[model samples]
Target: MSGAANPALLLGASLSAMAAALHLAIIVGGAPWYRCFGAGEGMAKLAQAGHWWPALLTLGIAFVLLVAAAYALGAGGWSAALRGLPGLRWVLLGITAVYLLRGLAPWPAMLLQPELRQPFWIWSTLICAGYGGVHALGLAQAWSRL
Candidate 1:
């Protein structure tokens, strides 16, 4: 399986890594779109609401995971890059679960609210489904190759 390099797997890993990097950059850059996630604008609200530390910690965790993902992508080599990552399959599995639930689960009441409907969850659902599916397929292909 080491020599059975699957380009799709490598490409999928690269895509996931790039997305993580972009997400981290957005958080660091104070992107307003992140307001919905308690990162930028929401941080102020969270601070006043007395839950700032937990939210901040969550964001920090996400950043760490993104960095780890990036490192895995780099370590994953040319022939079997995706398969090369030490524990990437588990990470991918976790990501897939989150995305699937976010995208396919019954819509939450908060997301149904008129004001937040447009940008909060609907778009995320679509993005998560598409992106998650791509990664899942990549994982599946890579696993099969392995």
Candidate 2:
């Protein structure tokens, strides 16, 4: 990895980390949080009923996001150990694709199922797109090192 940190990747890592933290906070905040975060009324109800599935699923997401953040950090040259991770390039590519795909999902949904659209969909799409854009730029900038 280069000695200099890639700012785009660093920002991507921060965004992922923040998302992971938000997921954890949602778990702590319970049903209200689920509802507030647009997790769906059913999920909120399940959480309110003390179902383990909701928290478990959310925790899994948080873990994945945290790992992605770490990978981004490593790829960005912020962490030497992480930079040595196996399949770093492929992993980063997958993460970038996932985010971009998610960001684009709402567009199709908006056309096919406008009734199901919500404010959350719009906001989440923008956020995911921004995250993916940052990751893509960083990945491109650091491609040779990885």
Candidate 3:
């Protein structure tokens, strides 16, 4: 099936793209934004100290999101880099599983002292499930055609 005709692939790609953009925004938002997102005062203080951990950590997360986006796009046969790889189906599955695990596995640890990230955790879990499921479905369809 054509990439555009595949709803699963499209949804996966869209989610990945959205995640990547959000991560990039976090990087751009710097310390205040990070702190606002529940990163803690230590991180904010570090940012004020010119440590750049806020940006660096966000960059790492952004890199992962970018990789996920590439994987999603590749699910649709849109990337030459992914097209030639061996065991691509397994790779896609692995990526999907990672996303699912990240969102579903994190505990209800307090973001700061007594406050838990209830809403963020809930939303993140759902988003990751959606992303993982979409990619899995798309990869399965693509593999079937192969």
Candidate topping lDDT: 2
lDDT tens readout by residue for model 3, 11-63: 78778878778767866776786676656778877876778677788778778
- lDDT (10s digit) by residue, model 2, range 1-146: 66589999999999999999999999999999999999999999999999999999999999999999999998999988898878999999999999998888778878798886788888899899989999999999999988
**Candidate 3 wrongly placed segments (more than 4 Å):** 1-5, 107-117
Backbone Cα, N, C clashes tallied per candidate: 0, 0, 0
Q: Which predicted model would earn the best TM-score? A: 2
Q: Residue 59: error of model 2 in Å? A: 0.2
* lDDT of candidates 1 onward, in order: 0.55, 0.93, 0.70
Which candidate, 1 or 3, would have the higher lDDT against the true structure? Answer: 3
Model 2, runs deviating above 4 Å: none
Q: What is the lDDT of residue 8 in candidate 1?
A: 51
lDDT of 1 by residue, 1-146 (tens): 44444455455556556666655554454434356443445564554455646346656766654644443343333434444555555766666566567667746654566665655467767766766676566566655433
In terms of lDDT, the poorest run of 10 residues in model 2 is: 108-117
What's every prediction's RMSD, in angstroms?
A: 4.7, 1.1, 3.7
TM-score of each: 0.60, 0.96, 0.75
